[model samples]
Target: MNDWLLAPTLQGRTLRLESLSEVHAARLLRHLDEETTRYLSRGAPADLSVESVAGYLRALNAVPNRVNWAVVTNDGDVAGRISYSEVRPADRWVEIGTMLTTPFRGTTVNPEAKLLLLERAFEVLGANRVHFKVDSRNERSLRAMAKLGAVREGTLRRYQVRPDGFARDSVMFSILAEEWPAVREGLRERVDAALR
Candidate 1:
């Protein structure tokens, strides 16, 4: 099994994915709010204090199975975060998730981040499948996943309970290794167009 504990920094044309660090905590705190955390059942904690965010970053860094990264723009500003979890080396699969600041929501930050992450997962990590499980209520997220060329697998009913005690359905999507070549080309085109 690959040790995702040691995360590698992933660089792209307009953004970089660095290992989650305390330095990013303050910037991350600025983006954590009810609206940002709504669809995420295990989203950032309610406390937005710098200290709390730092502590959370520390804890995330300590985890051995999950790998997290802070998304930074080319100009050196933190934009958001992305992570690979539920990594199973034997199965060669991982789940990708993100929490982006409002400013980056409709921008290319997310698509670029996912492009880099998926490249690493499929090309470097030898992952056979890269998947996502999004809250069914989040239509935006569902559409975004589709835009990435991931096929919707199915929906898991009552898959999770939110912080607000609401039962949430999870919509699953994935891109298999066999399907990666076309997906990669599509993503590369989108990213190239965005960069232009």
Candidate 2:
């Protein structure tokens, strides 16, 4: 666990965000469907197992300057996971990422979960910026970032190597501290509309 930051349980109208643990492994493992795994760096998750996922979640605790959360729905089902990494306390910034199941993709969970995370980063943690990096081919994630009102700061070509040894581009997006109010309100409106 990092001294500067610890994962906090964040609540929203439609869902809850709690620090991820092995207890969530089975449900999170089930979220590893083809549609949801394709865009991820691991790509299709060939050898994924509950134990492997549990270990993965376990290892996350030792990662410096990063925090992970399991998104739980009102129904008590595990929706997926969201995390912010590349956290620089001195710089007061973080890069957020998500891996939600296909079922929750277009629902209130995404925005409200993001609302909670962004709220923590900006309002609670005193971060000046929160950024995202989406695989260029992942249109769904790209759209999510745009919908969140983050500015697209261009792409980094061939930024990461995929599990299959293929290179992929990453689209950069960020929200500055000055822009949080508008983005937070937009997310709230979307979340509220989805809840209704």
Candidate 3:
């Protein structure tokens, strides 16, 4: 949809969610490390070049229903990336995906990013449901999602194959429109507390 193609820049006290573009490739790649991507289906490339990442970002521009954002900290550093994918407008369902560099892991970047996206999904876009699928082995990520109040649905066994050949399970979590208010307030409180 056009909304995915032109996702307006979202701002928060701690970060800015800007459309992922070629120019952000270098900044995003600068902080990426093997440990940070260990949970992904394809591990960090042995050679993670700016050109490659840039090409990927550019290519994503044409993907119809996915919108990717560069998670930029207030000081103008690209801290990570987040996106809304698997968008099904007719069904009012969407999925959120994210990867944050270690430097910003413990900060408000994650929560604030969620607040913005969830707000847009439920409030602005009239989504009936928003979900996230995370590698089950990623305890930190699982905990983070649970902490945000997304109800755990179940695990998809052998959902993805890691680069090293491990069949990874994926944990599904979701928040329905009816559940949005509480989740939004929790995220707002977490993010707002940090802003103070």
Candidate 4:
């Protein structure tokens, strides 16, 4: 068991990813607007309280399956969340996911945040392939994944259930260890253009 897998911070200049703690649930709840919940596999409660979200984070923390982070913006507000889950330590593979808040919905934060995670996964964690799965209906996410140079391998039919109780198809994407440099460069340029 790696005790430090739960480290509390992963920061970039425009964004920061910190371990989701009780202190963050209140502000994190603020990011869970309707539009933000639409494509996500999980949804915020109708009137989610800080303590409840804290408990959720605690439960996730207890499980060895994944690590969740509160996506904090440059201004220090909780903007959303990103996680590295379904890790295969023996194979050095992992999946990346996030629930960006509504305000960050149409911004550069999403791509930039992902760039950070991808970097950590491949360069730091020495992963072989980093995977991303999006709902087939989420065109925006698909486009963003394309922008990051993820190759669409295929779709997972009826892969998971949606928040609305219907079966949702998942579009799978991946970036191999060999493709990181070019992908990273492309994302850096995209972020630069978006800021201008």
Residues 52-123 of candidate 4: C-alpha lDDT, one tens digit per residue? 777756765565768787888888788887888567767788888888877887677887888888888888
Tell me which residue pairs clash in candidate 3: none
Cα displacement (angstroms), candidate 3, residue 73, comes to 1.4
lDDT of 2: 0.85
lDDT of each: 0.83, 0.85, 0.85, 0.79
Q: What is candidate 1's CA lDDT for residue 122? A: 90
- Tens digits of per-residue lDDT, candidate 1, 25-140, equal 88777666667767875656648788987886787666656888999998887888888856778878988888887777877798889889888889988888999999998988
C-alpha lDDT (0 to 100) for residue 170 of candidate 1: 95
lDDT of 3 at 138: 88
TM-scores of the candidates in the order shown: 0.92, 0.92, 0.90, 0.88
Each candidate's number of clashing pairs is 0, 0, 0, 0
How far does residue 78 in candidate 3 sit from its true spot (Å)?
A: 0.4
Q: What ordering of candidates by lDDT runs from best to worst?
A: 3, 2, 1, 4
In candidate 2, what are the lDDT values of residues 62-179, reduced to their tens digit?
A: 6777788999997888998888867888888998888898888888988988999999889888889999989999988888888889999999999989878989999999999999
Candidate 4: lDDT of 122? 84
- Candidate 1's TM-score: 0.92
Model 1 / residue 99 / CA error / Å? 0.9
